[model samples]
Target: MEGKDTDQIPLLIPYKLGQIRLSHRIVLAPLTRFRSYNSIPQSHAILYYSQRTTKGGFLIAEAACISRAAQGFKNTPGIWSKEHIDAWKPIVDAVHAKGGIFFCQLWHPGRVSDQSFEPNVGQAPVSSSDKQCSPLVDGGVEFKFLTPRKLNSDEIRPIVDDYRMAARNAIEAGFDGVEIHGAHGYLIDQFLKDQVNDRTDDYGGSLENRCRFALEVVETIANEIGPDKVGIRLSPFSNYMDAGDSNPEALGIYLAKSLNKYGILYCHVVEPRMEVMEERTECVVSLGPMRRAFNGTFIAAGGYEREDGNNAITEGRADLVAYGRLFLANPDLPRRFELDAELNKHNRDTFYSPDPVVGYTDYPFLETII
Candidate 1:
């Protein structure tokens, strides 16, 4: 891929995301691979991330829990302690050695978690509301969410501070930046989605109120690390874990406009027609409006293939396209897209499998393909 012509593919073209110049617009989406053991990033991740690294390419690491209270799933990495921060250093250095720009995706699962994953044992996870998220069953996997205790008004500041600390930890771990996980019915989305947030506080009820918690996190993170090193992933169009909005378009537009106040490095949005269920019936199919409203680098994700991804960048639907499953199976995803080569199929069974190398680092590169 070093010397081969890019063939004028829109996704292969160079673009600048803040001061960080990317050689291409194909992003490695933040996916929960469930390989990190005991809430700390394992050594296997070094090769896993390094396999996908390319010169000047951007890769967002798997979502790392911002604090003990924020954990919602098993085996997911964390950024809350000295051990967690130290564990991520070598992995970050591996990606940097390959000249890839890595961003640690900091998240708080909030109510999306269960009792077993909690640090305080049976203590309920915190969220904007006390409503319990429905259990998730996909691809022969089942996850039952515990009823979350609603955060008291005064309790909100501490969680925000956790996010700030996580961002600082990400930078100290040698990551180029951090992407806040505000998408997919996690802690932040719990506030944004009216379907689950049944509150009448300063953080719920109105659009601004619902979004207040999110913007505060943005402001605090931006102030802690600097706006240029910050980005956020949002999913206003889809509902997972029963966190649906009454009006997604308005919610998306509101958040997009509000995010401009902080001037974050980029806004990565999950594309429509996602794993949306009852919300899918709403037929929300475009990210154009949100992309237009946000006055920064825009990254569109979810179910994009080579042609459509190229079209998105060229037609200005987004400045970049993030690939999840495709990239997970094809470590040389950028090279494959460049050559229009056959991609290896992804095995769903191993997506969250406990095996370290079976599906984690076993994906083949073009050179090794017979």
Candidate 2:
């Protein structure tokens, strides 16, 4: 889709975002490609990320599991160990060398995890409640999730501490900042959604209580690495991993209002149209109200075409637009958007393949084809 001709296209404009100044409003969204093996980032990751880096561009790295217990997917990277930190250092440095700002996304899968992928084999996943959902299978049919063990009150603090330590590890690995992956039915999302969080303790039940786990993790990460360097990703209406909120609109506004006090760098929200891990619902809540609630920079993602992204930024709905699949297929996506060039379609088959470079760093630049 072509962007409308205008004197100023908001997507191409430079903006100052927190401590980092962005050259354009296009952000590379965090995507799980399942390329890392044994929870360690590989050499191809450096090439993949650097290929997408543009001067002053913002790139949020794929969600890195905060601890061994937090892992859910196969071959996904983590930020828990010193070895992991060392592995990520070169990737971060490569992006920085190209003048791109990189943020490591801190993640925990909670009840969404599979026993085979868990650090302790044969152990069930942990979550706010003892509910079960389907575990992700590569090129296979979905399977039922093992009933997760409910996190005890004493165990909650340690999980929060894991996020704090992960934030420190991200900084030590040369990341410009850390983004708390509180969205899309992950560990944090499990706590935020009432459908999943059935606990009567202080960490569940009421909206404030349900949101406590998310808040604590964010606050701890923000405190560990200055709030100016912290950002969060949220998906209120997302039904992913069986995480559907009773009142998505109210939940979104409340979370935004609460996050306002933290002075975080940005709030990255998934647009209502895209379905992450579940079937699309008929009910769609507009992100307009939530955008207004948060005073910081707002990033909108999911199913955005060139024109749609430009319009969202031009209409004042979002300060920036994040592209996932489009960026994956087009390494120089920002330049393509600038010149209104044709976008290479992403190959769905190789998206999560374990291949080192088939879909990782093989996408050609516009100049190469020209």
Best by lDDT: 1
Q: Which pairs clash inside model 1?
A: none
TM-score for candidate 1, residues paired by index: 0.96
Give the C-alpha lDDT of model 1.
Answer: 0.89
Worst 10 residues of 2 by lDDT: 275-284
Find the number of clashing residue pairs for candidate 2.
0
Off by over 4 Å in 1: 276-285
Task: Kindly report which residue stretches of model 2 are placed more than 4 angstroms away from their true locations once superposed.
Answer: 1-7, 135-144, 276-284
Error in Å for residue 269 of model 2? 0.7
Candidate 1, poorest ten consecutive residues by summed lDDT: 275-284
lDDT by residue (1-370, candidate 2, tens digit) is 2345534767988889976788899999999888889999998999999999988999999999999888787899999999999999999999999999999999998888765555668788899989887666543334346678899999999999999999999999999999999988888899999889899999988889998988888888888889999999999988877898898888899999999888888999988787443333444568999999999999998788899999998899899999998999999998899888899988777888899988778988999999
